[model samples]
Target: MAAVVIRDPLAFAAIYDRYVALVYSASLRVLADVHEAEDVTQDVFVRLWRRPETFIAERGRFLSWLMSVARNRSVDELRSRGRRHRREALNGDTSDDDPATLVPADTDDPVLAAQLHEAQKLVRAALVGLPADQRRALELAYFGGFTQQEISAALHEPLGTVKTRIRLGMQKLRRALENRV
Candidate 1:
């Protein structure tokens, strides 16, 4: 690996080729926005190229270390953007009834609107089925855009418990909705 870092150009290129997709996918999972994910993915590789000496094999496998960096960076980006979005919302600079503010108003076709409406109904039903605490946690985190720590403070629950509830609630919701669909 060190030889690849120092002596062989093709070996470094091979490493990038092997790991680029994994890094991009990890970024996409955290970001959920294609353009932002793509930008972050490129940045991750650029950082790796600039600081190949920073990666120590003793800490973990190369891909594992790379993935950890990618995931952390993506999450940090999301949290930063989320904070900015919440600040904007709190300032009341946004229009409440603007469809564009919530979701894109113009769909390319009617079928897309029907599919979106159906998905919304299924999600609503799933939320209604959750236990009150779990539902509240999910709502505050998802709709209100509160972080787990914020939700814990707001609901007077431990941060770990709030995170667990949200994770479990989402797992159950996914299963239930899968069966329905």
Candidate 2:
């Protein structure tokens, strides 16, 4: 890992070849989007290459560490998408009004729609199960597209508290969703 981190191109390439499939499968398992999974896998490898010093072998096996990094990256991507969706909503984007903007307008795909609807419901339920502060923080950050500073200002809380809420909320939501699947 240190060799890879120290700009050893061969070592880094070897690491990529060894873990790319695992990272891709993990992302796909969690996100269920092939393109997004591929992007996440690439992003994870890029981050690994850039910050090799962060990979501490004492913490766990290399595979475990890599998986943790991949999982964290995927979660961040999901949160980012959530923020974008909220921003678009605030700007008057409505999927029902213009199906083509959200999905293929001519394709009346019930199975795809149903799967999405089910996933949405599960996420909603998981969000509702969170503690009040955690749920509120997540909603403001994710659904309102507010940065941590903005969330703190809106909620009249300290920045650290807001971050804690967001972190805890996401952990709970991830655990809940993982258990379901």
Candidate 3:
């Protein structure tokens, strides 16, 4: 699919149609602004279309790689804004109308969609199994787009303590999702 997408515009469009909701959801979760999320979504897809070969199969699954791109780009956008209060992101507060919940049911590839849905469940369950402090720290860093120092200050913890929580949380998460992701 990646090879086909690199040479065929229609194939790229099909990929976009299948995964756009997930990509947009990742951005919206971090940015917490509709317009900015939309912009980041577009940027993600465009970059994928332009550089399909960058998706190395040995690294991990395509969906994981794509979501990483979306998350990183969203975080970059958040950092570029300088001195904005990411209250919603840092606190992991999501509204009822989260774009992820609104993903269209008629995706072009049902098998891929099913796999993605399963993957999301596994990741969420693993996250839920973590201790509260570790979960909060991980959420603030990844989903909230905060630096380790920023998270320490926001949560009123020592920098080393915050680092330890994030590192241990990540090790647990990686072990839990190693086979699935």
Q: Pick the candidate with the highest lDDT.
A: 3
Q: For residues 84-143, could you state the per-residue lDDT of candidate 3 as single tens digits?
A: 557656656554665556765446578877787787789889999999999999888887
* Higher-scoring candidate on lDDT, 2 or 3: 3
Candidate numbers, best lDDT first, in rank order:
3, 2, 1
> For every candidate structure, what is the RMSD over all alpha carbons to the true structure, in angstroms?
10.0, 10.1, 2.5
Candidate 1 regions off by >4 Å?
A: 84-147, 151-160, 163-181
Q: Against the correct fold, how does model 3 do in TM-score?
A: 0.85
Q: What would you estimate as the lDDT of candidate 2?
A: 0.70
Off by over 4 Å in 3: 1-6, 56-59, 98-101, 104-108
lDDT of 2 by residue, 52-120 (tens): 888888888887799888876765765677654434323321223433333332233455446545766
Q: For residue 26, give model 2's deviation from the true position in Å.
A: 0.7
Q: For model 1, which pairs clash?
A: none
lDDT on C-alpha atoms for all candidate structures: 0.69, 0.70, 0.83
lDDT for residue 148 in candidate 1, whole number 0-100: 88
lDDT of 2 at 139: 57
